[model samples]
Target chain A: MSARILLVEDDEKLGRQIVEHLTEAGLEASWLRDGGTALGLAPQNWALLILDLMLPGAHGLDVLKRWRSQCDVPVLVLSAKQDASVKVRALELGADDYMTKPFWPEELVARVQARLRRPVLARADRVECGAIALDVAARRVFVGGAEVELTKVEFELLQALAMRPGAAIARSWLVQNVLPPERDGTERTLDVHVSRLRKKLGTAGAQLTTVWGIGYKLKSEDVA
Target chain B: MRLATRLALTLLVTALPLTVGLVFLRERAARSAELDALVDYARGRMESGGREACEDAPEIFQDPPFRLPGDRRFGGPAPRDPLGLGRGPGGPGPDGPNAPAGAGGARPLRGRGPDFQQPPGRAEPAGPAAARFELWAYNPDFRSDNPAAPALEPALRAALERGAVLASGTFELPGRNGLPPRGGLQAVLRMAWTDGPCAIVLARRIDLPAEGSLLLARFGLPALLATLLVLVTLFAFLPFVRRVRALTAGVRRSAASGYVDPVGASGSDELTELGRAFDTAGAQVREQIERLERRERSLRAFVENTTHDVMLPLTVLQGHLVALERRAAANEVPDPSRVREAQEEAHYLGALLENLGAAARLEADELPIERHRMSLNRLIERAVGRQTTIARGKGVELVHALPGEEVEVEADVTLFERAVSNLVHNAVRYGREGGHVAVVLEVEGDEFVVRVLDDGPGVSDEELARLHERSYRTESARRRHPTGTGLGLSIAKEVCERHGFGFQLRRAEVGGLEAILRGPRAKPGGGNRSTA
Candidate 1:
């Protein structure tokens, strides 16, 4: 089930439209005219708080600031004030993310989905994709229920790709996060490790794909 | 002329003639005294028993007396009365029998008769002084049997009657005593003795010292003093002249550069004061010019920022409408997404107008925001509700999470709401599609913290730091969304600051951007607590 969003906004027409749009995108959204009503709601029940910086009763920044101390719900601030200082200030006040005014509806829905999807991914200690299963804590990989051996670099590469399946990771990011401190591996070296890891995986190696100019991605299931 | 030269010239001009006159007077006094001294010596010699030798003795005459050549008597030729007998009519010549032996009468005394011409008391008998002086005796009785008697005139007799006669004449002394016919200045004196009146004549050769040497001795020291005066004047004025020249050059440079560079001021003098004054004036002028330039630059930046802000929304709206028209012309219903996008652009244009105006008012320090203790939660609720439609159109969810208890804070309600609205709108606009935007308020001890977060493509760490700057779009930001007013966060920041709240932008652990705004928590007794 998609997580519910609590929307705090003052304009009724804009408020009604945002709720409708979010509902049509298959996410439940509830609207409030002011920070007073939103501040009474339980943050743990909602996946995200979509907040308008301007409100009629309580300032949106104030609500975000007050509620964040009590609960850990991710907050997304909506602001028509295009000044970056406002965005930075909101970010500093415990806002999880921000969008300037005049954003696409599709972009908004995608952001909501991204925020909802993070916890599901973060809770997993082991990731399984198609015929490959990775034990993240123990740093082990299994292909077709058979264990596969991997070097430290190769294992880290596979783990980084497995964390976000089907998503392309940038080469520079992978080089920064997955490579061992002493290895001093460049992207080219990373590619060599990936090839070696694929060879070790054997049939399961087909799931590892290069994303052209980007780095790499792992797929558990192939698309038709 | 240079000051030193001028000073030297002036001093020398005054001193030169004065020195010359002083030397001339000194020389005259010296010469007159010398002549008087010589006359006194002659008179003294004649009175000290030298008159007795001249009185009735031909021995004083020796064989021949030393005389200057070209001597002419006033009446015809002098009578040859060497023995004081004025009876002989012929002049004494070398052929005369009574002529003294070896009396050729025209030779210097050096090679002539040595024994006869020797003066009685002189030592060094054959030197420059050998023929220097000669003495002649005159018979005052005016009668003589000897043929070599000198004849006297009435003027001489008159001078003798007055006790003594002193006279100077140029004449040749006879070389009869082996003395040359030496031309000399003759000093003759007549005096009355015990026997009769006797006349003694003394003569010395006229070999005067060199005129150049005499002139130098008489004037050298004073000339030296005048030169010294010139030198002293030059030395004294040289430094003053150099300093004056430096001052002039500094002034010229000041004029050349429009009073930009400082003039050097050294020493505790009047010129130093002038230099200091010039430096002060120049500094003031430079500061004024710089201030003007700075003002001009800021004005230019203001205009550029205004133009950029105005054009962005218009361009976005135009682009959206064009795409919508294109879709409609292709025989399809205009997509709801396109309509919502155009509406969002129109909303952005409205916001841009409001924010730009508000920014102006803030800069002019005329924004009137009344502050009072108000419910911070209620303000956040109103802001979130205001941004809900845009958030929905963008498919971004707006959420507000707050404590059930009322979060009271001191603020201007209208401005506070606008600040909150801008933050939420920013999240809805920049967050990824289907990503969630949230408003959450937390209470930490005595502070109320409000945060807005979004799960979207967040900025780099470097970009995050610079995001607060007005209208600053990073490279990735410009590529992602080509249209934005770029004033939302800046206005929100202004409102929060005006309300004395702490504000910051940070990275969210939820993998997106976070904005934080903090203010003081209200007291439990419903009293306001100040944060700033």
Candidate 2:
């Protein structure tokens, strides 16, 4: 089933654009001009809440704080302030991720998709693609029956991309999911991680292919 | 008047009366000596002449030796001569009666009677006897009908001759009817004349003013000296008083101008030293105010420049949005270029805001850091991983070297990560394409040291020193990242300082720039386990 997102933003044009883009990307996105009506809706039904800091009815952070106490749904704060303190505040208020405004619709959708996918993906203890196997619980990895020592970041990156094997994950999505929020990881940094991940995987690294201008994908050898 | 002048006036007032008293005493003493000498001369002459005459004319002396009352041989007619007999003006001498008696028939003397009163303010003579003398006739037939008639008073002669050669003595004479006995000085002698031996008596009044004159002379000079002392005291301290007044006025004036005025030193005295001290203090105050004003002006400029910078990216993003909208309205597939441009501007705005917020919070002293025990090695890897994609995009290889085990640190995870991220981000942004960027964390002498280095064109020594200044960009940095906010290193420095860590930037060994952050190694159980 496609993920459904509840977006609460005050800016009419940006809000409309984000909703349209998300709908086109084959996700069910409902846009609300204020936070009050969005707060009345059951948060558990939606895959994620895309909240803006500046809203008409209720403060975005307030709504997030209230919703977070009742449920464990993910929240992505899209604020125009781009202030470090604001970002830290939203995260401290139980927001899963935060993005500043004036954002490209593609990056926003990519972030939304990553936030929705993280919970489902995190439930798996073992992540396997081709001969590369990542043991999430033990923090260990095996490539072609040979156990290899992987750095914490390399394990996170491999597990994040290999969650949906053979499917392209946007560079922004991988960076958002694989990197800790406090880290200043960019798309270019994501590329370097992938290259390092490839080297660590050895011959199994061939199964991982760059999507070219989009992101990276891991494929099983039998399917390729 | 100043204090010194008032003091001088007081001295002068006290000295004046003393000086006058001394002068009066000196004058009185000289006059007293003159009067005493006159009396002595008269006594001496009468003694020499009368002694020989009295010896030769003893029998002749019995006939009318004392003057009759009507006789005018003395200074004035005898007291109360009602008939004015002997008013022929044949007085005692050409001079006043106070003069010595001349060589003639010995004149009768008078006491202080109504006809012979002394001047006012004249003190009485020192001796207990009346300061006057009179003669008495020993032969009864020669006496007049006056109440003070002559008595055969041989005891008077015996008493007068019993003393020194001058033979001065006090004797009471019979006064007028119903009057008290009056005392007088008497001098009697016997001397031989040509015929036979005769007895004679001489007497005079002792004046009071002469004695007082002697006392006034004693204190006169000391009073004069006291006046001089007052003048000397005024002269000694007057200059210091004047200098103090001028210095006080100068300091008051200088205070009004924020201590910027110069109080010049003009002498080698203490006042001049005080002036030099004031000059030094004024210079220091002026310099401090100037520096504060300069810093305020720069802070204002920094805010304005930050606002201006934020506007540029916003304008670019607006343009990109307009292009994307027009393409969407045409119902054609939108070109990715417009979207990509908008994203780039958005990213730049985000980075700028982050720097601005960090700098603002750091300066405001409100950046909250919640520290916890965490794996420093893992944090470094994550921080380097965040820059990996960007470094690769710029064709720069990112390298991170860490310790073998978990290096636990008591840190605020977000801020610590941010500090490391800023260094790596700057390295990737300014380092040369295809160059290497390295992040290293290791133990150095009980400190956890983190170093970020890149083989990019490094700054000169001058630029390296200014890297931590807010919004200060070097020449090479400007050439590489034209739109860099220049707040990254400052933010890193502030974070390190807030955490009691040491931070520095220097030329890297890899022919580039290097940033080093050092923090104290965490002790066991010192850090909280909970972290964000």
Highest-TM-score candidate: 2
Two-chain DockQ for model 1: 0.01
Which tens-of-lDDT digit does each residue in B1-532 have in candidate 1? 8676677778878898878887777666644443444455344434543454344354444323332333211111212323221112112232232222133322332322222333322221221212223334555554332334345445644665576656554554455465344443445555444344344444232322232454455578889888888778778778888888898788778867877756777899888998898888888887777766765664565566667766876898898889888988998888898888888877766655555555554554444565555667656765676577787888886666554356887665445666777777878888888887778776777999888888877778777766665432222112324322246777778787777888788778777778899988666666433211
Task: Provide the DockQ value for model 2.
Answer: 0.05
Q: Report the TM-score of chain B alone for all candidates.
A: 0.39, 0.43
| CAPRI level of candidate 2 | incorrect
User: Which tens-of-lDDT digit does each residue in B146-260 have in candidate 2?
Assistant: 2333342456455544542334444555454654455433444332221222223333333222334433334535665876777687777787778888888888888887887
Give me the candidate number with maximum lDDT.
1
RMSD per model, one decimal: 21.6, 16.1
lDDT of each: 0.64, 0.61
